[model samples]
Target: MPTIYLSPSLQPFNKYLTTGDEQYWMNLIADDMVPLLEQNGITVKRNTPGTTLGQAIRESNAGNYDLHLALHSNAGPVNLAGKLRGPDVYYYPYSSAGKRAAEIIADNLRKIYPDPDLVSTVATTKLAEITKTSAPAVLVEIAYHDNPQDEAWIRNNIPLIAQNLAMSVCEYLGQNCAL
Candidate 1:
């Protein structure tokens, strides 16, 4: 059986930000993906509190996981308090599989976010989650939390967001899923 790593973002402890803890959104995203993956006959090994995103992918790599997906919401220096929007799919640089998976996800997200241009791009050259994973890896920043509209969408469409992501993965792997 093929395994997939589901990693949600940990709480951000930055002092200047005023927003809900990100873990709640992460967990919701993880929960949303699990049933869909299971429905497609893909086994999921979720990352827990004790593990960093990179560690989870590495450990899963040592096992049987074919893919590693990290779920997150973005907040940027310019878009500080619910002001910026759009989803960004991040892939490990130089990995064909990672790029393919990101493109699939970007296509899926575009359907849901018809107004904005959803982008699939390479991660920052130094991010460990993309740089250190042995298996193909993609991290999805679903939307910019600093944008009120995006936050509202994140809050209201958790299931849709999760479903879109899972569908993309299944599509990339050519698995038939019921929903």
Candidate 2:
């Protein structure tokens, strides 16, 4: 079975404009994703809620995982806070596998997000989770937590978001995702 290391955001202080913190909602989505992945014959290992980002990367590196998927809601730069919207799926610029995974994730997210055009795949080397992991990695910024509309959308569609993400992972792994 293809294995994944699931790292939900640990940023409890990054509060959503409408309801909960980034950590709370990201964990809820990750919680929903686990069973769907398992049902599709994928092995899922997850970071603990309180695990620091460094610790999560270390744990994922120690495992023989096919992918490392980090779930998070975004926050724009201070000047653009609460104004920016949409999902940004990120990957290490040098990893083609990471780019493929990120693109697949962004495409899948476009199906559910309000504006399909706003969902994009970004290539970067600054993120620790993507840069330090042994497995091919994609870090999905599901939506802007600082934007009210985006926050509400995520809060209302946790299960749908999780399902879409799980399906995307299955696609990347070449597994059948019936749901």
Candidate 3:
């Protein structure tokens, strides 16, 4: 079976606009995705909560996994906080596989997000989640948690978002198992 390193955000300090923190919500999504992945023939190696970002990266690096998927919710910079919205799936600029994963994830996200045009694949050189992992990686910022509308969307649609993401992960693994 294909294995993936599922690294949800470790940042509890990043709070959502309404009721939860990024760590809490991202983990909730990861929680929902695990069973779907397993049923589809994918093995999941997930990061432990309360661990540091460095630790999560090291755990993922130590594994012989096919992909590293980092789950997160966005929060814009000070001036733009509560303003920006949408999902940004980030991949390492030069890693074709990473880019492909990002595209697949973003494409599926677009189908469920209110503003399809806002979902995008971003190539980056800075984020350690994608750059430092051993496997081809894509870090998905599911939506802007700081934005009211986006926060409400996340709060209300956890199951739908989880299902969509699990489907994307399955597609990335070449499993595409409809379970």
Ranking by lDDT: 2, 3, 1
Model 2, residue pairs in steric clash: none
lDDT of 3 by residue, 1-179 (tens): 79999998999999886787999999999999999899888999999688998999999999999999999999899999888999999999999999989999999999999999999999999999989998999999999999999999988898899899899988888885976
lDDT of the structure predicted as candidate 1: 0.77
> Each model's TM-score?
0.88, 0.98, 0.98
For each candidate, how many residue pairs have backbone atoms clashing (under 3 Å)? 5, 0, 0
Native-referenced Cα lDDT, model 3: 0.92
Q: What is candidate 2's lDDT per residue for 1-179, written digit by digit as tens? A: 79999999999998877677999999999999999999989999999788999899999999999999999999999999899999999999999999999999998999999999999999989999989999999999999988989999999999999999999999999998887
Once model 3 is optimally superposed onto the true structure by TM-score, how far is the C-alpha of residue 71 displaced, in angstroms? 0.4
lDDT of 1 at 55: 73
Worst 10 residues of 2 by lDDT: 11-20
lDDT of each: 0.77, 0.94, 0.92
Candidate 2 vs. true structure, TM-score = 0.98
